[model samples]
Structures are given as structure tokens and as C-alpha cells.
Target: MDSASVYTRCQDRLLDLAAELTAEQLATPVPALPDWTVLQTYAHLAGVCADVVGGLVPPSDDTTTARQVAERAGDDLDAVCAEWRSQAPALLEVFARETRARYRLPALDVWHHENDIRGALGLGAQTLDADQLAHFTVGGLARGWAPDVPGVRVVAVDTGQEWLLGERADLELRAEAFELARAVTGRRSVRQIAAMDWKGDPSAVAHRLPTLPAPEVDLAV
Candidate 1:
């Protein structure tokens, strides 16, 4: 689906969005990601692009990554935004050259963070390609995203896409394409996801999801 091109388009919009924000506004805390301000979030988005383009994610742990992003985050919002703008083309170029399956996480990372900025600023829903999202949702599930809920049959009613994950084939989740992608991307609240149509044990799968109001203890262990 040319995820790099999709990511570039989405990223250009985000950079434009950042250009509109004031320094004071950039410092304001984001509701969607309380631990980071808009500036830090912007830095993080840049950091991810830099890591991907440079292949320099040392330690390969969330804590280390967070520390690097936090350390690099600055009050110069325009410069940070500009940095991302400059670096993105190369990242997108790499993405374009790589295999489709290689984009599983980068596509999700950029897409989720774009929505993160959009959601925090109350910009409302951004344009999301259903087919792309559906592809990622299916891929994420197959990659053991929700391990406890083996046997999930997902159908996006909008695009009429289907994916059978796991061997059990007992539970089914029916939702719009974007919701399904957001659910798997660690964006949706637990309550919001549990409310979706389910043919089997909801709690079993719901608890397994990487969700919001995040767990207090880091379960990286």
C-alpha cells in the first residue's frame, strides 16, 4: 500500500500542524500522552524517524529510547519540527525501498503518533486509509498482539476485509477499520475496546491489549 508515501503525506500534515502551534502551546501537556508535552511528542516523532533512518536505536529497550527522546527534546519547537521535516524524506525513501512486511511497526508508529498529536490538539479525526489500517490490524494480530485471545476472526465492515488470527477461531471482533487499528496501536481506552462486538470472552482479550490509562508497573520483564 506504499506505506512510506502514506507516512510522508501524514507527516507533512503533522509538520504543518506543528508550524501552527505557539511555543507556549507546544509546552502544554498532551491529554492523550500526559507524560509528554507537544514539543516532546514532536521530538519523539522525530526521534523515531531518526532511529529508523540511521538504525541507531541502541539498547533496544523502551526505557532507553524514552531517555534518549527525553534528553533530546527541547523548547525549540520550530527547529524540532523542521528537523523532522528534513529527515523524513530519507526515512520515507528507505521505507519505499524495503519490503511491505518491514513497515509493520514504522507505519504503525508514525500513524499512531500523528493521531497522537492530532488528538491532543483537538484537531478531530485525521484522514486514515482504511485499507492500510486494516492491513496493519491484521498483521498486528498475527504477530501475537493479543496473545491470550487466540482465535480472533476480525472483519472490518467498512472495507469487507477479513483476517483469521490464531487456531481457535472462536472469538470475532467487528468494528470499523480505524477503530480496529487504533485498538491495536495502544491508543484506545480499555473500556472503549471492550465495548466492541465480541462473540467470545471479551475480558480475556481486552486485558491482553496494550491499552491506555497504562499499567503502573512497566511489564517489560
Candidate 2:
């Protein structure tokens, strides 16, 4: 599926899942985001869509994010889902037209958050469009985190897909694309990253792994 379709379908799936959840389930704490509950997470997602639709840039600052959550504090899953669905179509058009990675961020963000919500709800990983999107997400994260010099050569064993970031291919990493997507996005701990197949010392290139430090404990999804 295309990027727009991928994001649209993911949003639809999330809304469908929300429809099945009770208030208690919606209040479930997301392990990835300890400070936010499932409903809070949905609120943030909807807030982002609102920002994007309104032609405002999404900020990662704590104050802005906290405000986003606070604005929808009283909202339930149904309300938040409706808000997101309303703003999604406009963003979907942007996704379909923009070729730059910047425009692709929403698709990646929504997919990543969908899995986060799924995990907190005790749902298994959704594999529908995972394989198609995993490569892009993993490669983007790798490139974004990698240094200007030669750093890592990531090889997706499942699909034989390869992404050589930086100027040269020095450190080789072998793993499934989906796992690499999770790992590079701070879903895996540093210790877990070290456990993956590596041709060179993972610690040598640890600085290029993630923008923030990986989780201390394994976050099984």
C-alpha cells in the first residue's frame, strides 16, 4: 500500500480497536510512554492531526505536548477517535503528494503509536502493512540517527533488504526489519540492541543508535 493508504488504514484500525475498549481499557498505562494512559495517548495523536491539519508544526516540547493532552483531558476514546478521523483526510492527501521524508513522518508516527497502543492493550503486533512500511521506518530512523561518517550497514534478514547509512558501510547489523524498526525507534534496550547480530561491536556505534537512550528494560510488544 502507499504511504497515505498505510496511514489511513492504521488510523481506521486504531479507531476500530478503540470501539472495542472500555473506559478501564482506555485508561491502561502505555509502557512506552509511562506518563500517558491509552486515552491520553489517543488524545496526543488526535492533537497532532489537528496541528497538522491546521497548518501548524507539531512540537515535541513537554509544554506543548502536555497542553495537547490537557486540552483533551476529558475526552473519551470515541471523541478522540472522531477528532483524529476528521483531520486525517487532509493529512492523507499531504502524504500522497509529498515525496520528502518530512511529509512521511506522520505515516511513521501513527504506525509506531498504533503498535504502542496495541501493546498497552495486550494486543499482538499488527502485521498487515508492517513488512511494507518497516523498511522505510527503519531506514529513516537509521539515517536520522547515524553520524555523518560511515556508521552502520543494516540488513533485514527477513527480506534481504539493506540500508547503508553514513558515507560507508563499516558496522553491519542483521535483524528482521520489524524488529529493527522497533529497536532503532527506542523500543529496545541498549542490552537488547547488543544482542542483535552484528559484524562489528555494537557499542562502537552505540552513539548512533537512537536520539535518546534505549529503554533500560525490554519492552516486549
Candidate 3:
């Protein structure tokens, strides 16, 4: 699918899930993302959409702070979802009018956040399609964030996907895209990575990945 189509479909899926949640459920802690509840996750997702869209078009020299974005979204989960829904069309329109090279934010964030919400809500039974998975894997590796660790082949066993960063394929680790993404982003443990086989030191590679803050459970009480 094209960028606009993907954004629209992602928005639809998010809204559909949002509509099914109760206030209590929305505030409840997410098992997958222990740091954020459903409500907080919704808020963050909406805030990200607003921030990115606003960054692209911008709002007349009005620079919004992170706190402001969170505050504006408030604790009303549905309202936040509605705002995201409203923004999606405009964002899609803007994206359609522009070229892919000009697209703001990394492509991984788009799919990562989508998977994040789905995993948190237990709605992602089906994995990403072959094309999407390949895109994410290759794009992630090419992004060059992985450290110069020797013998580490970042492999997604489910998809038979592998990206050899260094000279040797000494470490063979297996995980789903989300898990792999999280590991690459330093949010999850390499130990949590299933079917992991390694010859060299995994810690060196782990250090190269971005250190994601531990998932927090703060929500509207």
C-alpha cells in the first residue's frame, strides 16, 4: 500500500480498537507495554500523530512542548482517539501531496507504534505481511543504528529475515518484528529473545542499540 493508504488503514484500526475500550479498560495496565496503560498509549499515539503532522505543516510559529502535547490530549481517552482520527485524514492528504523522501519521522516508528498498540491490546494475532516485514527489517538495518558488533546477525526467525551488520554471523537471535525492534531500540532484553544462538559477546551489540526507557504504568486513576 501507498503511504496515504497505510496511514488511513492504521488510523482506522486504531480507532476501531479505541472504540471497543471502556474507560476502565483504557486505564488498565497493558501486559506487553507495562509502562503504559491503554489510555496512556492512546494519548501517546495521538500526541505523536499531532506532533509529526504539526511538524510537517507546522502551526504558525507555535512550537508545542512535550508537556503541552500531553496536557492538550488530556485523560479523556476517547477524545484523544477522536483527535487522532481527525488528524489522520489531513496527514494522509499532506503525505499524498508530497514525496516519500520528504516524509517526516522514520518509517519504523509508524509501524512500530501501530504494532505497539496492537500488542498492548492483544489484537495483533496476525504478523505483518511479507512485504511489510521485509520493509521494516531492511529499513531498520539500513538505518545504521545497530552498533559495529562483530558476528551479530539480527535475525527474525518467523519471517526468515536476517541482517548481517558486521563481518561474521556469530550470533543468531530470533524474535518477532516488534520484539526485535524493541531489542534493537534497547527496550527489551536479548535474553527475552527466543531461539537465540550466539558465538560472540551479545552485550557489545546490545550497547549499540538505543536505550528505551522502561515501560511505565502511569495512567488516569
Candidate 4:
């Protein structure tokens, strides 16, 4: 499906999942993110969905994004979900007319947090949207998350998709497409990212990976 479809479906899914959860589950610690609970992640995501339609992306960074979540991360679970639901429609409407470039951030954010909530609740995962994730990882490495050193050649074992970042590439990383995407998006910790097969200095490359917040637990690889 397209990015907008992905965003809308994900939002609906999270809302449904949140509704099924108790207040305690909503507050469950997500080791995948630093000092954040499921409610906080949802609040952060809902905040961004609301912010995008209001014509404010607030510069894609940890500090700013955290502030957005903090602003709306009220104590009441139902109230927090309501806050998110209220703004989801406008974000979906905007995504319908715009390209992936417009919705990519929120789309990926939602997916990343989907796994985060699941992981936190000890809910087993089956698979992810590999097609979208593959492309998102490429864009992340190329633009928003580019490493400063020589490019590392990333090879997705399942899809056989490959991409290079930086100059004279000496590093090689191989893993499931979804795993790499998770690591790049900060859903997985440095340890989990390093768990993937590599030929070069994985530590060096790991340091450069994007930081949504380093997960406390080992994420699926």
C-alpha cells in the first residue's frame, strides 16, 4: 500500500490496540525507546500527525520531537488517544494529496512505534511492511540519516536489496530488510543493530545510525 494508506491504517490499528489495553499497559515501559512508555510514544506520534496538518513539522530531531510528545502526553489514556484521533483525519486528508515525501516521516514513525508498543507489551511480531521499510531506509541513509564516514554497503538478505552511503565503501551489512530499517529508525538499540552480519567496523557504522532513542532491550534482528 501507499504511504497514506499505511499511515491511516496504522493510526487505526494503534487506536484499536490502545483501546484494548489497560491504563497500566499504556504505561508499560518500552525499552526500545529511552525513558518512554507506550502512551508517550503514541502521544508523540499523535502529536506529529496533528502538527503536520497544522503546517509545522518542528524540525525532525529528538529534542523537538520529544517536546511535542511531552506537550500532549497527558495522564489519561483515553484522553491521549482522543487527542491523537482528533488530528488523524486532517493528517490523512493532507497525505491523500501529497507525495510520500510529505507523509514519510509520520508514516515511518507510526510503524516504528507500532513495533515499539508490541515489543514493550511482549507481543510477538510476525512481519513488517518490507516494501515501504526498504525505501524508507534508503531515504534515511541518503538524506536525513547519512553517515559522516565512507558509505557502508547494506544488503537485505531476504530481498537482496542493496544501497551505499558516503564515499569509498569498505563496510558491508547484511540482515533482513525490516531489521535494518528498525535499527536505522531507532526502534532497535546499537546492540541489536550490531547483531546483524557485517564485514567491517560495525561499531563505527552503529554510532552513526539514527537515534529516535536507543532501545533498552535487544530488538528483533
Leading candidate by lDDT: 2
Q: What is the C-alpha RMSD of each candidate to the true structure, in Å?
A: 4.5, 2.4, 5.4, 3.0
Candidate 3, backbone clash total: 2
Clashes of each: 0, 0, 2, 3
Candidate 3 local Cα displacement, residue 198, angstroms? 3.8
> Sort by lDDT, best first: what order?
2, 4, 1, 3
Candidate 3's displacement at residue 65, Å, is 7.6
lDDT of each: 0.68, 0.77, 0.54, 0.73
Sliding window of 10 residues with minimal summed lDDT for model 1: 212-221
Compared with the true structure, the alpha-carbon lDDT of candidate 3 equals 0.54
Best candidate, TM-score? 2
Per-residue lDDT of candidate 3, residues 1-221 (tens digit): 25565555566766777778777777676554565676766676576567666764332121343443456544586678778778776676567665654363323344555566656655643244434534444455546644445556666666666776656676655555545655554344444332234555666565444334423331111
* Model 2, span 1-221: residue lDDT tens: 37787788888898888888898988899987788998998998898778767765533557867888999998877788888988888887766666666666667667878888888888898756666666776666655654655578888888888877776777888988777777777777788888889988777675456544577767776
Query: How do the residues 60-90 of candidate 4 rate in per-residue lDDT, one tens digit apiece?
Result: 5778678877787554677778878888888
RMSD of 3: 5.4
lDDT of 1 by residue, 1-221 (tens): 56776777778788778768976777777665668887888788777777778874322256755864776755377777777888888887777666656444566666766777777666776646756865765666666654445677888888888887776677888987777777765667677777788888777776555533432322110
> Could you give the candidate ranking by TM-score, starting with the highest?
2, 1, 4, 3
Q: Where is model 3 more than 4 Å wrong at Cα?
A: 30-35, 56-65, 73-75, 97-107, 118-126, 129-134, 142-148, 176-178, 194-201, 210-221
